[model samples]
Target chain A: MRILIIEDDQVLAAGLKVGLGLAGMTVDLVGSCAQAGEALATTAFDAVVLDLMLPDGSGLDVLRGMRQRKDRTPVLLLTALDEVADRVKGLDLGADDYCGKPFDLDELAARVRAIGRRGGGRAAPCLTAAGIALEPSTLSATLNGQPLALSRREFAVLALLMEHPGAIRSKGEIEDRLYGWGEEVESNAVEVHVHHLRAKLGREKIETVRGLGYRVQVAP
Target chain B: MSSLRRRLFAILVAATGIIWLCGILWIFVGAKAELEHVLDTRLQEAARMVDSLVAQNGPAFAAAASAAATPERYQRQLSCQIWSLDGRLLARSGSAPDVSLSDHAAGFSDRRIQGEYWRVYTIDNPAKGVRVLIGDRLGQRDQLAVDLVKGLSIPAILMLPLLGGLLWLSLGRGLRPLLAMAVELKAREADDMRPLQTQHAPAELLPLAAALNNLFAKVETARRHERDVTAFAAHELRTPLAGLKTHAQIAMAAGDPGVRQEALRHILLSVDRATRLVRQLLTLAKLESGLAAGQSERVCVGDLIEEIGAAAQPSGKDVAVRIDPALRDFTLTANRDSLAIALRNLHENALQHSPEGGAVVWNVTPDGRGIGVEDEGPGMPPEEISQATQRFFRGKRQTPTGCGLGLAIVEAVLREMGGRLVLENREGGQGLRAIAVLPPATSPCP
Candidate 1:
């Protein structure tokens, strides 16, 4: 898989190239927007790592130019500015992901690979963890290769947690995902769902971190 | 002593006095003149009657005068005297005393008799070679003058207070727009930066209100910019610093020594950068927030300098602190946190700019009215001193030490504390000197 990096800082770009290259990807580095444009015209890449600020112009311009040419390649934006408005602008420009500067090289490589896998159409349409597989496309789940019939509420609760594996999804977020807009949720709906999910899947499948929320660790 | 109300009131009172004096003089002079004219005309008619009677029957004129002497007939009306060309007294009116009129036989004359002023007119009868002298007691003339003055003065005296009251009321009404503005200002919160709503303001005061609102708009923009910078710095620094620490931990757990050493070096650089970034962020936040509003405490300048010196000593620089005995005992009312931040920035700048082994001196002394800080470093050139306190500005010689926000923060803190910070060269070109002049405290120094 080939990934293009558009960054102004040579040191950061070189570091990213080495890191992402080590993650089983071919990396092409370009330091300016002009060079990025030239590379995009001559080559087909699975994903592009774009820095928001460039010496020649803004990365938003590059993103817009790509979209104008009907290019659907996933673009991830890297910026030092963490302002809310800037993030909104990058997302509105059709960026696949946004990461701020001084990011973990591992995190960056993972995002790049995810975007690449998503672009390749081989990315998982279903999330499987700890003996349970959730088919997001059909809003269905199977345990041990057998269909596990669940209520609509249980399916929603599991889907939200599966979307962000290893992350502690808060109770409030689970409720929002389970309930429709303006629907008054039962105060203990998430707890009830977690109780049912644990009873159906195993007790150790869903772990709760105190003072935070619930997480489903991706099974090794 | 120079009150606007008092000055206006005095002006009005003086004008009233001048007008009253002029009116009194007019009454006195006009009444006397009119009275003299009437007396002259009456005297002429009396002389004509006496002359005709004496010519028709010379000795019978005395009887005629006597016949007219009835008190009821004249009704306390008139007094008259007649003198001949030979200066002999002629016919006189009813019980006219032997009081002589003036010997001057023509024109009008004023005289005093028995403490009463008289207006006398003398008319010459050339055909008869006789002079008729007519006189009226000055009391009657003075009485008319007094009556005229009383008529003019009564209403004026009665209306003076009313006029003053109206003037005061109108003056206050004229200033109502300013009062309304003051009331609105007093009602606002300290952090409220809303523009003043002055659409209903008086036309003359609208410009002043608009200018004030413009100033507030600028202040609000500046404050928003500072807040954005601080927030951005904090958020941007956090993830990188966290990643650096995590990577260093990962490297330390690795078995390779070269890789571990490189990771440690990277970690230290990242830590240093993070620390510098956090410090700048805090300083910027402190400066932007200003001194805590409504806080006033007695702060000792000398002790503050000592505290800063001790804090700087940990940075391994030999920072010397000097305190003038007079300033050591002096204290000022300020927010302690803000004052300490301002002083620390100055001391830190001095320390950073000095050579490795060179001394950084913090001199807190009375500068006739305030405290001064003197340092021993390659001082900023004269041209660069003015721009030193601008945001992100560094002198040509001092760019490498750190981010150039030190002096800017100092300037902001001083401004919030109601003091001025002045930068100048030390004597003999040793280094830079900064002076902070605080307002004199009310209580005497102990």
Candidate 2:
């Protein structure tokens, strides 16, 4: 999952980025309301972690702007204001979830994944197709009841493909989900990760069409 | 008498008792004077009647007077006597002593006869060769006045207790509103700071009720301030703690040694920030409690500055501090701890706000009434300068680690020491210069 954190505290923002990044989510950070608006307009994120008190204005303004634009990106409010009223107001403003400060990093990651899964219209905790199962919570995959060892990048690539088995994901869309801002992306990074995925998950699961993008199909 | 009701009651009762006493005295004096006049008139009448009897009934009246005959009604109150022209014993009533009633031999006179005091009236009849005397006892007149005073006193003495009771009851009725107010105050909960009802208060108690309500309002405002400070402190402390927790968690989970090193460093920074905030809060609390209050000591400005400057510097920034040499020997007679806290905050603020490797200049003001700290960095906007000292008021250019309490503490400390804080932009608009303007009394040491 790709996530954007709108927070003004530099130390906390850095900590959240590294922590969420290790959990197999590409995390980008913006320190003010203006920057958040710009990032939201330019990029698509799977989920948003918002801090209510920003330098220029409140994070609620950012959430309101997104909802007004009919952008249904899952927003999990992460703020220092843990009061019940603060939570209620954020949730009522189209937030998908609320997490107060000093929260457990594991719990935060799980909540983000939950909201992202729900936003994708999936009810199950894991994605399964054709004897292959992916558990987003543990970032683990199983093939025919055997556990498979995959790098974090390789896992992210496979998760994106397995979300909709028969739906095509263009190269650009996959790259957006895999890399955060300021992280160096190699020219063939997607191609290399997909090649590695094929060697492990079987090539018949994935198909490429000329002048289009990559897609995966479940066995009949 | 300290109680208003009791005092008023006492005054009223005393005044009434005095009036009653005066009334009885007036009646006693008037009755005594009237009794004397009537007795004198009766004596003259009785003397004249006997004189005429002696003239008409001649020898027979002499024989009657010798028998000492008197009217029944006047027997004890008055006496009659008859005497010949020669000095001789006169006929006397049973109540009168046997002696000449008067040597003058005519008209009203007072006489003492045979150890008895008498008021006597005498009539002379030279042609008839006889004298008549009427006498009354002085003791009898005194008894009548005493009896008359006694008649008026008995009822007056009896009414005293009733009068006192009525006064006390009426006084209590008049002061019931005050007692009700006291009862309402006593029954109130300690945390209930509501104002007392003034609309229904009595006219006399209006000032008291208004003053009490004003006091309650002040206390409520103070309590609200305390609550807000507590809430703000909790809110401020949570963010740093959250940062510490997140960084610690990241350090524990990082696989690469470089990432682990960076995370550990962040954890340390978070601890430092939280520690600073806690220490600042403690200092503010101490200032509020007035600990070491009003104890001023002569402190050398140069030594104090050197001690603080030698202490911890802002990590990773090498801001230079230039203290004017003229201030080295300067001293101030002020509260040592408060001055230290204020100067330390000012120094830290300047260092934190100064650009990397920039210089912070410390100097005395030209008027010799203040100290100045100038930093070479982005000064605050003019509109924000006034609100800069408000608690937790971070401006548009708030720093990441600032808790927004530095200027506020400085302002509080200065105010406690009878001084003020003056914030303004530097001359060229390159930075800000903060001045600690001391009162005239605390200008400098000789």
Candidate 3:
């Protein structure tokens, strides 16, 4: 799964990135509403973690912007404001879930996975296409009842592709999934991850889109 | 609760009863005097009648009565007698005493005869050489006076129960609104602080209701202020707590020594931030409780300013401190420690807002009535001066380590010293100005 975390506190944000990254989800973080908006326009993320209090503006502004643009990505608001009125207002303004500060990272990850599944129009935290199944909670992948071993980046790439079976993923968008802000990026990192995913999931499962990027074709 | 009702009834009922008893006593006294005067007139007329009969029918009429039934009421109620003016009684009625009733020479007199009080009238007709006396017992007159007063009192006696019933009903009706108000107060929810209803209350109770409502309004404001402060303090503490938790988690999860060391450093920093917040919170509480200042003492402004100038400089760093010469001999009566804290906070604010090379300037007013300080950095906006000293208020720029209680503490201390913390913008709005004005020496208020 791909997720974006928008929080102003650097230490908390760094911890969230590490925790969510270990859960086998590719996480990109931004500190302001404007940066989150720009990242949303440029990349495809399954869910967003929003903090109400931000350095530039309120996190609710980002949620309103996404909803205004008809972006259906699920949003979970994480804030220090635990008042019921604040929670209800955030939910009324198109937030999928609300968590107050001093939150448990594990519980936040569970909620993120739940919202991610709901965003994909699925009932459970498992994405599958043509018998290629990925369990988000355990980060386990299997092909036709046989377990498939994959690296973190390869698992992230496979999870993204399996979320929407026939949709094409641009190389730049895939690169955004594998890296966060202030990180060194290798030019062919996405290609290497896809090459590894194809070897394990079978060659025909992921197809190249020529100059565009890559896609996993649906079986008839 | 019922005392007010009982007091009203008891006082009013006792007053009316007193007035009725006094009226009955007045009537008894007046009737007794009038009855004695009427009986005296009857005695004089009886003496004249006996005198005329003695002139017409002489000694024969003298034997006419031991007492005859012809004029029974007069004969029974009064006694008649005639005397020779010498020392002898010539004619007498049966009811008159056998002895002379009086030793008087004329007119009317009171005499005791045979152990009964008697009212006697004596007429002297020297031409006839005889005296006539008419006498009645004082006991019978006393009895008549008692009967007259008793006859008048029956209606007043019968009216008592009716008056009591009316008084009770009127008093109950008058106090019904108060009872309703009591019930209204009793039925309220524990935290319900809405003003009491007064629209249907009686006019006499309006002031009480209004006073109660005013108290409710003040309490509500206090409750809201307390709630806001609590929430603000919690938020302040939680942010650092969240940071600490995150850093601790990262330290536990790190596999490399460098990463673990970095995480530990962040943890220490979080602890320091939390500690600073808690200490500031305690300082604010001390100032708010009005106990930290203790007692007022003589404060020498010159010595205080010199100490402030020397101590306020940053540790291991040279920060210029300037005090106006006019402040050298200035002295005031105030709480010394409180004054020191206020000055230190102001100096701290000036230092915090001043730029790297900028200096803080402290000066006394030309009139020598106030002390003012200014920072060299950009001043605050005009609109924020009103709320600058409010507790837990941070500007939108969000300065680092701004617990937002520094100015509030200074303001509280100044207020306790019978002074105010005045905030203003510098010339051309370049920097901020804060002034503290002390009470004049001659003023009585502390």
Which one is best on TM-score?
3
Give model 2's docking category.
Answer: acceptable
Taking chain A of candidate 1, what TM-score results? Answer: 0.57
Chain B of candidate 2 versus the native chain B: what TM-score?
A: 0.71
Stronger candidate by DockQ (2 vs 3): 2
> If both were scored by lDDT, which would come out higher, candidate 2 or candidate 3?
2
Question: Which stretches of model 1 miss by more than 4 angstroms?
Answer: A1-131, A134-220, B1-14, B34-77, B83-90, B123-131, B193-265, B272-446
Instruction: Count backbone overlaps in model 1.
Output: 1
Model 1 chain B: ten consecutive residues of lowest lDDT? B67-76
lDDT of 1 by residue, B322-427 (tens): 6666656767777778788788888877777666666655544444565777777778789878767766554456533345577777888877766778998887
**Off by more than 4 A, model 2:** B1-232, B292-295, B312-315
- What lDDT score is found at residue B131 in candidate 1? 61
Per model, how much of the real contact set is kept? 0.06, 0.58, 0.33
> Among these predicted structures, which one has the highest lDDT?
2
Cα RMSD for candidates in order: 16.6, 8.3, 7.0
Candidates' lDDT values, in order? Answer: 0.70, 0.84, 0.79
TM-score of chain B of 3: 0.75
Ranking by lDDT: 2, 3, 1
